[model samples]
Target chain A: MEPIAVISIFVLAVFVGFEVVSKVSSTLHTPLMSGANAIHGVILVGAIIVADHSSTNLELGLAVAAIVLATINMVGGFVVTDRMLEMFKGKK
Target chain B: MSRTLYDLIGLAAGVAFILALKGLSHPKTARRGNMIGAFGATLATIVVFFFVVAPKTGVAHALPLHHLGWILGAMAVGLAIGVPAARKVQMTQMPQLVALFNGVGGGAAALVAIVEYLHLGSGATKAEVIFTVFTVIVGCVSFSGSIITFMKLQELMTTRPVIFPAGRFIIAATLVSVIGVGGWVVAALGTTPLLILAGLSLLFGVLFVLPVGGADVPIVISLLNAFTGLTVAASGYVLDSVLLIIAGTLVGASGTILTRLMAEAMGRSLFGTLFGAFTAKPQAATGAAEERPVRSGSPDDVAILLNYARRVVIVPGFGLAVAQAQHTVRELADLMISKGIDVAYGIHPVAGRMPGHMNVLLAEANVPYDQLEEMDEINPTFSQTDVAIVIGANDVVNPAAENTPGCPIYGMPILQVANAANVIFLKRSMRPGFAGIENELLYDPKTMLLFGDAKASLTKVVSALKAL
Candidate 1:
C-alpha cells in the first residue's frame, strides 16, 4: 500500500501490458482493442464498492448509475469481442 | 471476509486478467481468452461485493443494504441494453458499437469518482482527492468524446470533420478553464467547482474530436480507450485497490501503443492528429482530364475478365461493408475458383476503419483464412496477378502514397495493385475516400472502373459468370 510500492507495481504493469499486447497481429487489433475495453470494465468493482457504502440518497443514486454504466461496459465489451473472435476462422 | 481473503481474491483476479490478455495475443486462443477475462471480471465484481460490502466486519461501520436494490436494478438495465446490442448488431457497425461501450465505461468511472468525492466530505487525504479529481476529468472527456464518435459512425451526424473559423481558440479557452476549475476543486474541496470541471471537460471532449476527419476515427477511438483506462487507474488510486491498478494500467499502456500503431499506418503522428489544423484538404484535380483515357466496364465485362484470368486478387474496403457485399464477393470468388483460377484477398493493416475489420467481414462470408493475404505478402504477387479486383477500396491501394510528394498520405505503405496487368475498381463515384484525398491509381490506363453498388455489381458479375 506504500506509494512507492504502488508506483513500482504500476510501472511493471505498463511493461507487461506493452509486452503482451504488442504481439497481437494487426489483423486482430480490433478484437484486441475490444478485449482491452472489457478489462477496464473492472472499474465496476469500484462502482459497487461506492454504492454499497453510500450514506446519502444522492450519493447512492449516482453510484447506482455508475454501476449500470459500468456493467453495460463490461458485459457488452466481452460479448462483442467473443462474437468477433468466433468469425475468425482458419484457412479452409 | 477477512482482509487476507479479500487480498487473495484480488490477486487471483489480477492473474486472470493477465491470462486474458495473453489469450488475446493469438487468434487460436482469443475466444477462450475473452472468456477467461470475463470470468476474471465476474470474480472481481463478486469479490468486491462479498468481501468489501456484505461482510459485517472491517472498516465499514454502517448499513450495507441501503442502495442494494438500486444497484441490482441498474445491472438489469445494463443487461437489457448491452446483451441484445452485442448480439444483433451487424458487423458493419462494430466501430460505433465499441465507441458506445467505451463511453459507458468512461461515464461510469467519472460518476464513481464523483460519488466517492461526495462521500469523503472534505476530510479526505490529499492523495485521495487528487486521484479522484483526475478520474473525474479524464473520464468525462472520454465519455463525451466517444459518444460524438458513435454519432459520426452511425451517420446521425456528418462523418466529415466539423471545423469552424475559431475552433482552435474555443478549444484552447475551454481547456484552460477546465484546468483552472479542476485546480480550484482540488485546493478548496468544493463540489461546485468539481461540477464545473466535469462540464468543461465534456465540452472539451466534443471540441477535441470535432476537427478530426473520419479516416482518423480509429486512432481517436483507440486513444480515448486509453483515456478510459487511465481514469479507471486513477479511481483505483482513489480506492487504493491493487487489482484495479494493475488491470487499468495494462489497458492504458496497450491502448496507447495500439493508437500509435494505427497512426503510423496512416503516416500521421498523434501530435499532428490532435493539434494539426486538418481543415478539409482540397480534393486534388485528379489529372483524369489530362491523362490517357481510363477504361470503363460493365459487370458483364468484369465477369468475362475474371472468367479468363488465371490469377486474381480482391482488395476490400469500408465500401464493401457499407454495401454489404461480402457474401456476393465470396460467391464471385467461388465461381472463379471453380474455373481453376487462383483467388486471394489483400488486407491492409488499418483497413476498413478498425483493425482486421475486412478479415472479419470476409470470414463472415466464409472466405478462407489462408486466402486472406496481408499487404506485405500480397503486394509482391500483384505483378503476376492477371486481374486485380479492388472492391470499394481506394486509399489503401492509391499509388500517391509512394509516388507523389506533398500528398497527405505520402510515404505510407500501400497495396501494389497498380502493378497488375489489369486492375478493376468497383467504386460509387470519383469522390475521394475517408482520407479526403484523390487516388491517382484510378486514372491508370490499366485500371477499369466498374461504377455501381458493390453488392449489385458483384451480384451481376456472379450471374454473368454463371451464364458463361
Candidate 2:
C-alpha cells in the first residue's frame, strides 16, 4: 500500500472513532474503556506474523512470548468486557 | 485460498468492530455488541493466521512459519491464564486488572515490532521502518506506563505524586533523546538504535506517570490505552493489515475522547493534569491540628433519622467499594422503600476509581438502573431532600469544590448532598479522601459522622431498620 493511501485510511478511521463513541452514558464508560482495550489486541495479528517469520531461536522465543501476551490481552479483555456488559444488560 | 478473499474477511471484521462500538452507545444492545466484537476479533485472527501468514507461497513466504507448535502453545497458555482471571477478578479490582491487561497488549505490540525489525533487517521499506520504530516507541511506553498505573491502583506503590526537582525538565530531555534516536532509526533502519529508543521510551513512560496524583490515574489509564492503540495501528502499518489499522485507530480515537471527558469531569485541562503538580490538601494552621467537633451517630440514630425522612439520597464513593458495602447499602435502601420513603442513589462521575465504577458495583448487587441518578440529575433534588446518607463518600460531596477559591478541586462538579436538610457521613476517620484533601462538608452544621467500616455500619443500620 502507498503511504498516502495508508494515511488516508488512518485519517478516516480517526474521524469514525471520534464520532462513534461521542455520548456514551457514564455507566457504560468502564465497559467502553475495557472494550476499546480489547480492540488493540488486534496487534495479536502482528504477533502471529512475528512468530511465523522468526529465524533465530532467541527471536522465536520473543515472538512466542508476544503471541501469548497478545492472546491473554485479547481473550481477557473481551471476556471481562462481556461480563461487565452482562451486568449492564441485566439491569433492565 | 485467494488473497482477495482474505482481505474481504478482514473488511467484514472491521465492519463488525464498528457495529460493536455502535451497540455500546446504548445499554439495550451492549451485550450483543460485545459478542459481535469478540466474533470479529476471532474472525480476523483466523484469517490472518491461516490464509494470510501461514501459506508458504507468494511474497508472504519471506515471513515463514518456523514452528507451528509455538504459536498454538502460546495461545493455549494465554487462554489458560486469561479466561479464569477475567472470570474471577473482584469488581473492586477491575480498574487495575484492566490496566494490567492493557499493559500485556502493549508488551505484545512492542515484542511484535522488535521481532519484525529483526526479521526485516534493513531490507524493509522506508515506510515500514518508520512505522516499526513508531510502534516500538509507543508500545514500550504504554507497556511501562500501564504497569506503573496498575501498581499505583493496586497500592503496591505510593499513590501520591512522586516528583523531584526539575522533573518536567528530565521528561523533556528524555523525549527529545527518544525523538533523536527515532530519527536515526528511520534514516538508517538500524536494529541497534531501536533497542535504545525503546529503552528511553519506556523510561519516559515511567517519568510521565510518576508525578500524576492518584485522582488522575483513570485519565492516565485512558490516555495510555490510546497510546497502546496508536502502537497497534503502527504495527498494522508495518504488517500491511487493514483490520489492525481500523481497530487500532478506533481505540485510539475513542480512548482519546474518553480521556478528555474524564479530565473535563474534574474541570481540569489535559495539559494541567499532565504537567501540573496536584496537592489538594489544605495547609494546617500553626502546624497544630485543632480538633473540630462532629456529631457522632450510632446505627439506631441513623435508623431513626431514616425512618421519618420523606426523601433520601444515598451517595456512594470509592470508600464504599473498599468496604464492599454495595449489597448492604441496597438492603438499607430496600427497607426504606418498604416504608414508602422516596430513595435514590447519587453517583458522581469520579466517585469510584474509574468512570462508572460505582454503577457497576451497585448493578452487580441488583440495584435498579433507574434508581442510580447521575450527578446532574440528582444534584438539584438534594436541597429538597429530608436526609442524604453518604456511604463512604467524602470528596464528591465536599462543598469546597464549588464554594472555595484556591482549593485544588475548585470548579469540579460534586454532589450537593450538603444542601440536604440532614447529611449522614459514614467514614473510617477524619482523614481526607483519595485526593488527600479535607472535606469541610463534614463540619457542616446539619452533618453527622458515623465512623466504622462501611459494610459493618450499613449492615447494622439495616438490622436497626428491620427492628424499627
Candidate 3:
C-alpha cells in the first residue's frame, strides 16, 4: 500500500469513528465500549496472517497463542455485549 | 483466492464494521448492531483462510495458508473457553469480565506485532518498523493496564489509589525510558530491544493503572480500550490489511470519544482522572472510628416512609451490585409502583463500577426502562420527591463531591438526594466509599440508616411494605 493511501484511510477512519459514537446515550456506554472492544478483535486477521508465515517454532508458537487470545477477545466480547444488550431488548 | 477478490471482500467487511458501530449507538439498534459486528468479524477471520497477503520477493517466510490445522484448533479452543465464560458470568461481575477480555485482545495485538516484526527482520521499511514498535508498546501497555483494572474491580487488590513517595517522577521516568528504548528498536531493529520495549510498556501499564482509585476505574478502562484499538491499527499497517486498519481505527476513535464523554458526565477532566492521584492532596482522616450515633431505623420505618410518599427516587451504587441486590431492589420498586407511589430510579452515569452497568442489571431484574432515569434526568426530580431511598450506594449521593475541594471524589457529579424531604440509606456499615472519602450526607439530620446486607434489607423492607 502507498504511504499516502494509508494516511488517507487512517485520517478518514478517525473522523468516522468520532462521528459514529458521538451521540450515544450513557445508558448504552458499557455495551458500546464492549462492542468496540470486540471490534478490535478483528486483529485476529493480523494474527492468522503472521501465523501462516512463521518459519520457526518460536514464531509459530507465539502466533498461535495470538490467534487463540484474539478469538477469545472477539468471541467473548460480542457474547458479553449481547448479554448486556439482552436486557435492553427485553424492556417493554 | 485472487488478490482483487480478496481485497474486495475485505472492503465489504470494513463497511460492515462501520454499520455495526453506527447501529450500536442507538437504543433500538444496539443488539442488531452487535450481531452485525459479529458477522463482519467472522467473515474477516474466515476470509483469511481463503486469501493471503502477497509475499514480497526473497521472503520465504509464510507459505500460503500454512498451519491450517493449528489455526482451526486454536479457534475452537477459544470458542470452548469464551462461550461458557460469557454465558455464565453473573451480571454483577460484568465490569471485570469486560476488562479481562480487553486485556487479552491487547495481548493478541502485541503478540501479532512481535511475530510480524521478527518475520520482517531488517528488510522492513522505516515506516513499517515504526508502526511495529508502536503496536508492540501500546498493545503491551493496554494488555497489562487492563489486567490491573480487572484485579481492582474483582477486589483481588486494593481499590484505593496507590500513591507512593515520588510516584510521579517514577511513572514519568518509566515513560521516558519506554520511548528511549522504542527509539533504540526502531534504529537498531533487533529482537532483544523490541522485547525490552515490550517489558517496559507492560510495567508502565501496571504503574499507570495503580494510582487510579476504584471510582475512576471505568474511565481508565475505556481509555485503555482506545489504546488497544490504536495497537490494532498499527498491526494493520504492519500486515497491510485495510480491514484491520479501518476496524481498528474506528474502535480507537470511538473509544477516545467515549472516554471523554464519560469523564464529562462524571465532571472529571481527562487528565485529572488519569494523573490526579500523583498531585492529590491527602484527604483528612475520616471520623469512621468514632462510632458517632446515627439514627438507626427498623425496616418498618423505611416502609412507613415509602408508604406515604407521593413521589420516591431510589438511588443505587456499587454496593448494590456487590450484594447482587438488583433483583430485590426491583421487587421493592414494583411494590412501590403498585401502591400508586410515583417511583423513579436515579441512575448515576458512573454507577455500579462501569457506566450503564446498573441499567443493565436493573433491566435484567425486569425493571421497566422508563422508570430508570439517568443522572441528568433525575437530579432535579429529587426536590419534589417525598422519600429518597439509597440502597447500598454511597459515593454517588455524597454531597462532598460538590462541597469539599480536596476530597478524592470532589468535583465529581453526585445525585442531589439531599433535596428530598427524607433520605434513607440501607448500607452494610459506616465505612467510607471506594475513594476512601467520608460521605457527609450520611450524617445529615434528616437521613435515616438501616444497616444490613443490601439484599436482606431490601427484602425486609419489601415484607414491611407488604404488611402495610
Candidate 4:
C-alpha cells in the first residue's frame, strides 16, 4: 500500500467516525463504546500474520498470546455489548 | 484468495463496522447493529488464515502460516474464557467488565507490535520503527491504565481519587521519561530500549488512572478506549495491514468523540478531570459530616410523604445498583402511579458508576422507558415535584456543585432536589457519596433521611404505603 493511500484512508475514516456516533444519546454511550472496542479487535489479523511468520521461539510465544488476548477482546466485547443493547427493548 | 480479493473483503468488513457504529447509536437499531459488527469481525478473523503479510514489504504471502495449531488453540482458549465471563457478568459489574476487555485488547496490540519489531530486526524502515514505538507506548499505557480502572470499579481499591504527595510532579516526570525513552527506541533500535519503553508506559498508565475517580471514571475509560484505538492504528502502520488501519482509525475517531460527549454531559472539562486532583482544593470538611443533625425518619414517614405528594420524582444512583433494588424501586413507582401521583425517575447523566448505567439497570427490571427522565429534562420539574425520593444516590443531587468553590465536585452539574417541597433520602449511613464529598442537602430543613439498605427501606415504605 502506498503511504499516500493509507493516509487518505485514515483521514477519510476520521470524518466518518465523528459523523456516525454524533447523534447517539447518552443512553447508548456504553454500547457504542464497546462496539468500537470490538472493531479494533480486528488487530487479530495483524497478530495472526505475525504469529504465522514468527521464526524464533520467543516471537512465536508472544504472538500466540497476542492472538488469545485479541480474541477475548473482540469476542467478549461484542457479546457483552449485545447483552447490554438487548435490555434496551422498545417502550411497551 | 488473491491479494486484491482479500483487500476487497477487508473493505467490506470496514463497511460493516461503519454500519455497526451507526446502528449501535440508536435504541431501535442497536441489536442488529451489533450483529452486523460481529459478522464483519468474524469475516476479518477467518480471512486472515488464508494469507499472511510478508515481513519485509507488507506483501501478501499465501498461507498456511507456521504454528497453525498454536494459533487455533490460543483462539480457543480466548473463547473459553471470554464467552462465559461476558455471559455471566452481572449488569452492575458491566463497567468493570468493559474495562477488563479493553485492557486485554491494548495488551494484545502492544504484544503484536513487539513481535513485528523483533521479526523485522534491523530491516525495519524508519517509518515502521516510529510506528512500532508509538504502538508500544500507547498500547502498554492503555493496558495498565484500564486495569487500575477495573480495580477501582470492582471495589478492589477505594473508588475515591488516590492522590498522593507531589502526585502531579511524579505524573509529569513519568510522561517525560516515557517520551524520552520512546525517542530512544526510534533513534536506535534495540530490544532493551523497547522493553524499557514498555515498562515506563505501564507505570505511566497506572499513575494516570490513580487520581481519577467519581463520575470522571467513565471518561477515563472512554479516553483509554480511544488510546487503544490509536495504538491499533499505529500497529496497522507497522504491519502494513490496510484493514487494521481502517478499523483502528475509525475506532480512534469515534472513541474520541464519545469521550468528549461524556465529559460534556458530566459538566466537566477533560483537562480539569485529568488534572483536577492537583489543582482543586482538598475536601477537608468530611469529618464534620458525622456531627451534623439530619431529620431521621421512619419508613412510615417516607410512606406518608409519598402518599401526600401530587408529583413524586425518584433519583436513582450507584447505591440503588449496589443493593440490586431496581425491581423494588419499580414497584414503589407503580404504587405511586396507581395512587394518581405523577411519578417519574430523575436520572443524572453521570448517574450510577457510568453514563447510562442506571438506565440499563432500570430497563433490566422492566421499568418503562417513558418514565425515565434524563438530567436536563428533569432538572426543571423538581421545583414542581411534591416529593423527591433519592434512593442510594448522593452526588448528582448535591448542591455543592453550584454553591461551593474549590471543592472537588464544584463545577459538576447536579439535580435540583433542593427545590422540591420534600426531599427524602434512603441511605445506608452518614457516609459521603462516591466522590467522597459531603452533601449539604441532608442538613436542609425540608429534608428527611431513612437509614437502611436501599432495598429494605423501599420494601418497608411499600408496606407502609399499602397500610395507608
Candidate 5:
C-alpha cells in the first residue's frame, strides 16, 4: 500500500510501453498515435476522479483544473483531427 | 497484497499494446495489430483502475459513484461524436483527424495541470508549482497549435501560409514576452498568473501556425503531436502518476522523431517550418503557361510511348493517394511488366502529405517493397529510364525545387524525373501543388502531360498500351 510501490509499478509499465512503441515503423505511426490520443482520455478521467475526491480546497481546485483542461484537450484534438480528415474527400 | 505481481502484469500489458501497434504498420497485418493493441489498452486501463487505484486509495474513494457517472457520461459523449464522425470520414481525411485528436490530448494535459495548480492554493510546494506551470504552458501550446493545423488542413482557413507585414517578428516578440512573463510568474507567484500565461500561449499557437501553408501541415501536425506528448508527460510529473509520465514520454519522443523525419523529407529545416508563409492564389497563375505547352499528350500517345519503352518508372504523388489509384496503378504496372518492360516505382519521401505516403499506397496495391525506390535510389535510374510515368505527382518531381530561388519550396528535395528520356505527367489539371507554386516539370521538353482523372488516365494508358 506504500506510495513508492505504486509509483514503481507505474514506472515499470511505462518502460515497457516505450519498448513496444519504439519498434513501430513509420507507416503505422499515424494510426497508432491516433489510437493513443483517444486512450489519453483516460488521463482526463483520472484527473477528474482525483480532483473530486480532494478533501481540501487546494486539492479540489487542482482536480477541477485538471478536469477542465484535460477535457478541452481531448475534445479539441478530436475535432481538429476530424477536420484534417475532411480534406481528402471526393477527389477524383 | 501482491502489488508487485499486478504491477508487472500492467507493465507487460502496456508493452504488449505498444508491440501490437507496431505490428499494425503494415497493411497485411494491420487489422490484427489493431485488435491486439485495443485488447492490451483495455487490459492496462482495467488493471490500473482496479489494482493501483482501488487497493491503495481504498475502494470508497477510488470508485466514487458520482465520478464514475462522469466517466461514463464522457465516454458516452465521446463515442456518440467520435464513432459517427470516424465512420463518415473518408480515408483521405485521416491526417486532419489525427491533428484533432492530438489537440485533445494536449488540452487534457493542460487541464490536468490547472487542476493541480488550483489544488495547491497558497500552501503548494515549489516542485508542485513548477510542474504545474510547465504542464500548462506546454499543454496550451500543443492544444492551440493542433487546432490551427486542423483548420489549415481542413480548408476552413487558407491552406496558404498567412503572413502579415511583420508576422514573423510579431510572433517572435509574443513568444519572448510570454516566456518571460510566464517564467517570472511561475518563479514568484506560482499558479495564480498561470491562467493569463495559458491564454497568451493559446494566442501564440494560432499565430505560429497561421503563416504556414497547407503544404507544411503534416510536419506541423507531427510537431504538435510531440508537444502534446511532452505536455502530458509534464502533467504526469505534476500528479506523480507513473503511467502518465511513461505514456507521455513515449509519445513525445516518437512524435518528435517523426516530425524531424518529415521535415528532412521535405528538405526543410525545423526553423523554416515555423516561419514559412503561404498565400492562396488561384492555381491558374501557376497552371497557366503549362496548359499551353505543346507536349500535352492523349492516352493513345502515352500508351505508344509506354509500349516502346524498354524501361518504365512510375512516380506517385498526393494526387494518386487522393484518387485512391493504387490498385489501378498496380494493374498498369503489372500489365507493363508482362510486356517485358522493366517497371519500377520512384517514391519521393515527401511525395504525399506524409512520409511514406506513396509507399503505403504502393504497398496496398501489393507492389513489392524492393521495387519501390526512394528518391535518391530512383533519381540516378531516371536518367537511364526509357519512359518515366508520373501519376498525379507534382511538387516532388517539380524541377522548381532545384532551380527556383525565393520560392517557398526552394531547396527542398525533389525527384529528378525530368532527366528521363520520356516523361508522362498525369493530372486532373495543371493546378499548383500543396506548395502553392507552379511545377516547372510540366513544361519540360521530354515531359508529356496527360490531363484527366488519374485512375481514368491510367486505365486509358493501360488499354492504349494493350493495343500498341
Candidate 6:
C-alpha cells in the first residue's frame, strides 16, 4: 500500500474520532482531557522506543529529541493542571 | 501481510476513541471515554512503531537504548509530579492546570520539529526550513503563554493586567524582529541558530500574555490550546506522521471553536484577546464592606423561606467546588424534594474554574444529569422560581453581568438569578469573585446573605428544612 493511502486512512479515523468526542456533553470534558493527558505520556515512551531502535544517527537523534519534548509536555501539563485545581480548594 | 488491514484497524480505533471522548462529556460516562481514548492511543502507538517504523528499518535497529531510557524516565518523573499534585490540588485551579497542560503539549510538538530540523544538518531545503520555523514559533509561544497563565492562575503573578507605556508596540516589534531573525537563521545558518531564535519567540509569547487581565485567562487558555494543536500538526508534517497530523488538526479546530465561544460569553472581541486590551480600572479597592448592603438572614428565617418555596434552583460556583459541598448540597436538595418542592440546579458555562465544574461536583453527589440545566435553559425559569439558592457562586450569577453597564463583567452572559422572587447567597464572607468585581446581587432588596462555611451552612439549611 502507498504511504499516502495509509496516512489518509489514519486521518479519516481521527476525523471520525473527533466527531464522536464532539457529541459528548460538556460535563465530561474535564475528566476526558485529564485521562487523555495521561495517555499522551505514551507518546514519550514511543519516541524513546523509536530512538533506541534507530540504525542511523539521524533517526536516533530525532527520536531522542522527540522523547525529551514529549516528556516535558506530559509532565508539565500535569503539574500546571494540579496547581490550577488548587484554586478551588477550601472555599466557603 | 496486508498493511492496509492494519491501517484500517488503526483508523477504526481512532474513530472509536473520539466517539468515546464525546460520550464521556457527561460525568457518568467520562471514565468510559478515558478507557476508549487510552485504547485508541495504544493502537496508534502500536501501528506507528511496529508496523511503520519496524518495516522501514527491515531488521536493522532504528534507535538507541539510551533514548528508550529517556522516555521511561520522563514518564516516571511525570507520574511522580502529576499524581501528588493532582491529589493535593483543589478543583478551583483546574482551568489553570488545563492551560498549563495545553502549553506543554504545544511546547513538546515544537521541540519535535526543532529536533528534526537539527538532524537535517547544515544545508536543509527551503520547505523543510519553513515548516521547522512554523513549528518552533507556534510551539514556543504556546508553551510560554501557557506558563504565564499558570502563574497568573496560581496567584504567583498579578491577576491584574500588567502594562507598560509601550507594551503593545514593544511586543509587536519583538515578534516581527524574532520572525525576521528566524527566517535569516533558517535561510543561512540552518537549525542551530534557529534554536536561539525560538528562545526569543518564547520570550515574546510570555510578554504577550502577561499584560492580559485575569478575567481574560479563559479565552487566552483556549487560544493557546489551539496553538498547541497547530504545532502538533506541524510536527506531523516534519515527521511524516499521519496520526499526529490527524490528532493535531482535530484539537486545533475544536480549540478554535471553543475559544470563540468563550470570547462571546465574555462579550469581548477576538481582537481584544489578541491585543491584550482591557478597560482601565477605577483603582478604588471595593472590598466586601464597600459592596452593596448585605441583608443577613438567620437559619430559621432561611428555613421558613425554603419551607414555603414551591420551586428552587441552586447555583453552585467556585465556592462550592472549594468547599467540596456537593454532598451536603445534595442532601439539602433531597430534604427539599421530600417537602414536595421541585428542586433543580442552574449551571453557568464559565462557573467554577473550568467548564463543567458544577456538573462534576454534582455528579460526585450522585445527582441525576436531568436535574442540571445550563444557564440559558434555566434562566427563564428562575423568574418563576420561589427561591434561587446560590451556593458558593458569585460572578456567574452576578446581576452586574446582566444590567450594570461599563462593569468588568457587564455584557458577559450570566444566569439571571436576580429575577427570582427571593435570593439567598451562601458565602463565607463578602469576597469578590475571580474577576475581582463586586456582586450587585448581594445588595438587592430581596436578596439574603447567609455567611458561613458552605458545607456547614448547607448542613444547617438541610436540618432546618427537615425540622420545618
iRMSD of prediction 1: 1.6
Clash pairs, candidate 2, are: none
Q: Is candidate 2 or candidate 5 better by TM-score?
A: 2
Q: How displaced is residue B94 in candidate 4, in Å? A: 1.0
Per residue, candidate 2 scores C-alpha lDDT tens digits across B1-468 of: 577887789889888988888787678888888888899999988876666463222256632255778888998999999999999998888999899999999989999988988888867778778888888888888889999999999989988678787776898999999999999999877778988998998998899898887778888999999989998888888877888888898889989998898888777778877865644343455223327777889999999999999999999988898898888898899999999999999999988888888888888888998899999999899889999999887778888778876565667789988789999999998877776667777877888889999999999998898899
Best by TM-score: 4
* Residue range B181-292, candidate 1, lDDT tens digits: 8888889998898898899999999999987777678888999999999888888877768888988998999899888877876677788777545533544575664455
Over A1-92, each residue of candidate 1 has an lDDT whose tens digit, in order, gives 68998899789989888888776678888898899998898899889888876778889999988988999899999999999999984545
Comparing 2 with 3 on lDDT, the higher-scoring candidate is: 3
Clashing pairs in 1: none
Which ranges of candidate 6 are over 4 A from the true structure? A1-25, A28-46, A49-92, B1-31, B46-66, B79-92, B262-269, B274-276, B279-292
TM-score of chain A, all candidates: 0.93, 0.95, 0.97, 0.95, 0.58, 0.58
Instruction: Please report, in order, the local distance difference test score of every candidate based on alpha carbons.
Output: 0.85, 0.85, 0.89, 0.90, 0.67, 0.67
Question: Which scores higher on DockQ, 5 or 6?
Answer: 6
Candidates in order, TM-scores: namely 0.94, 0.95, 0.97, 0.98, 0.81, 0.82
DockQ of the two-chain complex in candidate 5? 0.21
- Give the TM-score comparing model 3 with the true structure, all chains together: 0.97
Q: Which lDDT tens digits does candidate 5 get at residues B1-468? A: 255765576456546545544554444555555555456545654554454243112344433333445444555565566556656655556677677767766776777676556554665566666767777777788789888888877778878778787776888898997788677766776554777888988988888888886777888887887677767666665654555665566566556666776677688887777765633222335435655654788999998898888999998887887888888998888999999999998888766666655554565456777677777788888889999988887878778778866677777888888889998989897677877788777777888888899999888888888887
Off by over 4 Å in 1: A89-92, B53-58, B62-65, B278-295, B404-408
Clashes of each: 0, 0, 1, 0, 27, 26
* Residue range B113-195, candidate 3, lDDT tens digits: 99988888887889888998899889999999999999998889999999888888999999999999999998999999999
lDDT of 6 by residue, B1-468 (tens): 245765576556546545544644544454555556556665665554444433222343433334445555655665565556556655666667666666766666665666556555554556657767888898889889988999988889787678887777888898988889787876786555787878888998898898777777877877777677666655655554555655566566556655665676566777765664444444445653474567999877888999999999999887887887888888888888988999999998767665666665665567776788887799889889999999888888877767666666667788888889999999998877877778767888999989999988888887887887
Deviation in Å, model 6, residue A53 alpha carbon = 9.2
For candidate 3, the per-residue lDDT at B12 reads: 89
Runs with alpha carbons beyond 4 Å of true place in candidate 4: B57-62
lDDT of 2 at B297: 93
Deviating ranges (above 4 Å) for candidate 3: B57-64, B287-290
Report the Cα RMSD per candidate.
Answer: 2.6, 2.3, 1.5, 1.3, 5.8, 5.3
